[model samples]
Target chain A: MSIPNDRKYLSTHEWHKAEGNVVTIGITQFAADELTDVTYVQLPRVGATLQAGGSFGEIESVKTASDLNCGVSGTVVAVNEALTNDPGLVNRDPFGQGWMIKVQVSDLNELNALLAPADYLKNAGH
Target chain B: MLKHTPFYDFHVSADARMVDYSGWEMPLMYRSVVDEHQQTRNSGSIFDVSHMGRLHFSGSDTRRFLNLVLTRPVDDMVVGQSRYALVCNESGGVLDDIIVSRDNKHYLMVCNAGNREKLIQYFTAFRREHDLDFDLADQTESTGMVALQGPKVIERLASVLPVDVKSIKRYHFETAKIMLIKLSVFRSGYTGEDGIEIILPAMMAGMAMKMLAGKMDKENATLKPAGLAARDTLRLEAGMPLYGHELDENIDPISAGLKWAVNLDSNFVGVQKLREIAAQGPKRVLVGLELEDRRIARQGTTLATSDGAPVGQVTSGTFSPTLQKSIAMAFVDADHSAIGTQLSADLKGSPSQARIVKLPFYKRSNP
Candidate 1:
């Protein structure tokens, strides 16, 4: 799978896409593939505050569980509720319908610290 | 360096995700764990279990030696019978759980891969101390083992195997020849399903795999290649214990709920301690737990009462693909081990409601 050029990635494998004042956060395809079958996802509730480089929730696969991290500080405006019933969506389409949370970006400068698509692809050993 | 099984090339070519297990490079899963698990329950699946230890015991005093070491009585075991037994330390702590099979000329024992060297040393020391006469040979690397497990396994095997596999009763085995290679087929498995585990020479494993694969339809495989991940889940759903998780040198068969495999009347190494434990009752007992939600309560999770009193800790847990629920096995205080007892599992910081249930959460109706 190709890394979407429109987003910036964290070294921990979380992708952040900034659109106007909101940034949508999700795990990269490489991370999902490594987790095998995604059985459950726990996302931060709407209106919850999140800080950059802080854990926002959790993601669980059949074999293990991992923390879901955030790259941009903001208030969570929306969450992917569909994941509650269909966690496999993350395995099938990790970039689109698998987006975990949408945050009202508190600062645009935080995005500069994340890695570019090419850099992420290189660091991820693609 | 990790050891490679004879089926290593096949697993790689099949795109299996290989991992290091008990110092062996084995496949964790080929496609997905849940998919392989469902394939086993619905139809059939083949597993490469060559990493487990296979030991051959022979000599004039083999029977007497086994009777003194094994928790189960070996005198009554007729030829071609297999029994689940445990080797225990002097304090009654489980050293390892093994399957002892009575063959025509000798006895075969299969044990966990991680404990293979430890068990061999233990047995060797015992033989030296007691001046027992027997020959023990490590055949794990010289032989290969595979399990064909599922509801459809017997019918599929009956057509290809030279013998009547269906007629072989549970816990019994037969020796047969396939492609001029001698093979031992046992009507037994770790999964809670009807299946057979076969042992053959290492050099013939590839030919046997190809021959078995020819029987299945490629488009919709009847016997798909499963991995260690599915095998663990399948055994967990069946309420079977895994070494290092449920059984250890610090844990005993009495507390692990394996009393049936222990014959106290026999003068085994741990018979005296086990008898005392049986008379006084085990302080902690293994029990099954069903969580209220899908979040897995993994190993080492703390178990507590509704009032926040710590009761026990989880030994193994997974989101069951068959029952579609989160199930776990834990060793709680004997007073809290009864079915229907409500306990809470501390998942990280939050607590999840859990209820004690029967040991086996899933049972095949036809069997």
Candidate 2:
């Protein structure tokens, strides 16, 4: 459940690990912890252009359904195919294996404005 | 902030995933909902239902008090038998749906968890207004409940309980001292299964659970601890309606498809309003609907006709585990509530294909 210092986090509980032009997006461990057991996931389509803060997908937990928002502006490169079969990976390891999507960043400058791990933990009220 | 129950500690120790459910911090599930739900369907499942309310009535004519307070008959109740009833306001609007069991000296009223406080206060004022010679006690806080539910539950629990589990008829209950504390064992539950709900004294609840758990382990029984998450799905598959969602302070029992529980024979506060509604028929009736796709219609989502005209609203909805498709219950116009009627459920932003199904989406294989 530890968030790496290298990644930038969104206030909406998503983490963005940027490596040059490609960025990996996933809901935070805190988000997955709050969601409990994930049942079904409606993932975003690959090769689709999604602006920052847009809904990339939706996830249903045992109790309720929640929206997965885009952490940074990008065009969808790839999505976690395993999530379609076993959505519970979101609960197992949200930071690594449960990454929702791979996006080609539309705005490289936008990543600089995102919250750091310390600020993310503060904003999340943890 | 979520309100914690008296059994919050017990839930946490059992590794329950806690969640804020309508202001109550309750166990979502101890394990998985699917497993727990199947355990209930296949074997037995225990539930921590300590948050539910128990209102006691002890007076010479407590039977008459029930006749006055509920829409069900008090005179017809057999000893040790439980009957479902609707506690109504003056306008035939349902205040709450409850189960009342007639004990020799008192009547035990089990109300919904969310409506416990409001119902107790309502009865207090009603008892005062009519001079109903009965005492009302909200024993929800001090009482912890554990339900052994499913087909094999009675047989499994029989090893620990002294009573002949097979002899206890459905909906009948009795009081006994299980281990050390006084206990009330009711052969009743929400799930469509042969089971019993064990009510133990608040202090000795842990003892009761430990004994049950020990028995389960010794027998190598397929028993799992269920929670509110599995409880909801089980109730839904069994065609049970949850209060606040399906029935509110405004909905009448007649419209909720609970006429069998309503006793129109004797007069109650809402008898006239009920009679008027019965005579004219209700505008909307609750019905179970099955969707073709896996997309669920959430609560408060609007129901529409094929032409997109709004008809009613979804009261409860979810992807049914057993059915393997989306299933929901909605209050539709009485004309449309008929079985096999086609209706469009507005799934999020669009209408989804659905049809009115039978009351119980899952038909049990009765012995």
Candidate 3:
């Protein structure tokens, strides 16, 4: 339920932090808690272009799976390889060690479309 | 609204993730599925399985009636003995897998909750048509079932139970009293672990669980509260067949790798068809599948040849918390169900390589 004040969240449960034109992407703690015991993470390949609100990959728990969506239009620059072997990191540290991908922003205008931390917390019923 | 068990409030207070299961509001997990699963495998854990149906059969002709309906021969079963068997339809298709326990004066049958109504209807119809002189009573609503499982489970149970838990042999039950409430404690469980399932009055369920849980907390013991999610994973690791997942009305026990439960010489509802299937062999058979990768192949996933030709479908699959690998049970073509046959599973449209292996992905060290 603790959403980092500096991050922006999507209604689909993903969060992003824009540092200049580069953004770090990860699912919020709310999402992590909802999808308990993540076993596998299908991440988007590096250098793949993704549109805002589009699904880039999927995350699987023991009993269910959910698609991971992009909060803003960007090009995937780097994916967290640590998650490939230890998907439970998402459950342990959804904000810190569990970042899924880093992207180079393709449209800064889309950033304004995301919800703030407070708004996201309210929207997620946290 | 779904039906709730006696321990529903206990589960909610423990922060269980509730899910709808066969019209029952059941806890999927208390902490996490993987954690609970590991805890159960390494230490001790308890599960609330009261949603399953419990039936009592009594009358002068109880033995004859059950012997004719159940696949296993229960005629010679002594008191306190339990046998795993399947209730088959007239065409050899399975109605439900059940455990029949013989008490001193009557018989008790435990079956899947989803198949309770069907089973009761079948029993009623059979009795009416055949003029069987036995009384069938549905004991599920008033009974509460809890299973304490794992290697160290006996220690935790012995702490609270008055009886010497070790005296009851496997697949046997003994009548005892917990807090003055009569209980039928069975030395059996689904996880293939050494444990006991206590069946008691529904109103006493909360107190009984609190006693067990309190004992664990007081002694700093290894006993933890697990849920259906962990139960599913544990049973999958143990290679046990679930009712809706592995066995269904269209699937016969012979094809589901449950031939041991079926007695060819015994006269049951589907004995003749079962005999024919046994002689000719089933066209498809259930086999254990070991995925080469960590990708979990879930139920309904299409299994096929390595070259992409479809062969069968996965019935039950999960990531085994013990093995740290994904495993599945699939009903593949009988000829292709060999121990070393290579196959592929269409996991979300991508084919994952897998191989058929001998059942039971994990076995207890002492077992």
Best candidate (score: lDDT): 1
Residue B328 displacement (Å), model 2: 1.7
Per-residue error at B308 for model 1, in Å? 1.9
Q: How much is B3 displaced in model 1, in angstroms?
A: 0.8
Q: Clashing residue pairs in candidate 2, if any?
A: none
* TM-score: model 3 vs. ground truth: 0.97
Model 2 C-alpha lDDT versus the unseen true structure? 0.82
Model 2: what is its DockQ? 0.29
Clashing pairs in 3: none
Which stretches in model 2 have alpha-carbon errors above 4 Å?
Answer: A3-8, A17-22, A80-86, A92-99, A106-126, B1-6, B19-25, B215-221
Which DockQ-derived CAPRI band holds candidate 1?
Answer: high
Candidates ranked by lDDT, best first? 1, 3, 2
Ranking by DockQ: 1, 3, 2
lDDT per residue as tens, model 2, B1-367: 7766656787888888887775678888876777788888988888888777888889766788788878988787877888889989889888889999888877889988778878878877877887777777777768888888888888887887877777888889977776567888888898877788988778877777877755443334667678988899999998998998888889999999998888787788899989988889999999998987656788888888888888888999877777776789999988777788888887678577889988888866863
Q: Each candidate's DockQ score against the native complex?
A: 0.84, 0.29, 0.78
